[model samples]
Target: MWIFRNKSFKSAYISIIISTLIFASLYALSNFNKIGLSFYDSTSSSLPTKPKIQEKSEWLTNFVDPLIGIKNGEVFPGPCLPFGVVKVGIDTNDAGYTVDEAVTGISRM
Candidate 1:
């Protein structure tokens, strides 16, 4: 056969054929129970309902300020959106930017 023409290809073809047969047999065996049972309900007959769209009151973006704590001696007050990764701010101190300290350079975190 063409399968046995090449030594490497022969083993690969045999393995593929054996695996395919094994998987096919397993699939057939798995579906045998469902086939035997006449009243088997695999899925619901009713159609799926659509989800309702909820209307939110308002967004709290007004309350959020990216440069809120820049003047205070706290964390980095870099401007970034909610759940945002990239932030742009003034590099001042080791901890973060302060009001008293002069602007050294810009940084991203």
Candidate 2:
């Protein structure tokens, strides 16, 4: 088809097709309950569970420093860190991962 054959618009065309496929799959899964999430969760109305109330770890809660979770000096805090990957560049071949979104999709010069 001419839409898919346009060389200059290959990237945009491919991205749209991929996005459409992903959206269709998600919609089907949500409707059919093929995935782990049961579709009935939405159709059947249920009372919400009482949220847990926590009092401890107030210091950790108030801390906004993103780097607070990362330790550069002294003994290693822990093997598995609770750090956020602020930026990630995508590779087209990500084990068939259909989602190809940019962490910082748009940037200004």
TM-score of each: 0.31, 0.26
User: Which regions in candidate 1 have their CA more than 4 angstroms from the true location?
Assistant: 37-109
Question: What is the Å distance of residue 8 in model 2 from its true position?
Answer: 3.8
lDDT string, candidate 1, 6-92, tens digits = 899888888999999999999987888787753346586665668865545455665677666556646555577667577777776
Clashing pairs in 1: none
Cα RMSD to the true fold for all candidates = 11.1, 23.8
Per-residue lDDT of 60-107 in model 2, one digit per residue for the tens? Answer: 656664334323323322233245234232333432213333333322
Residue pairs with backbone overlap in model 2? none
Model 1, CA-based lDDT: 0.71
- When summed lDDT is taken over every stretch of 10 residues in candidate 1, the lowest stretch is 53-62
Q: Over all chains combined, what TM-score does candidate 1 have? A: 0.31
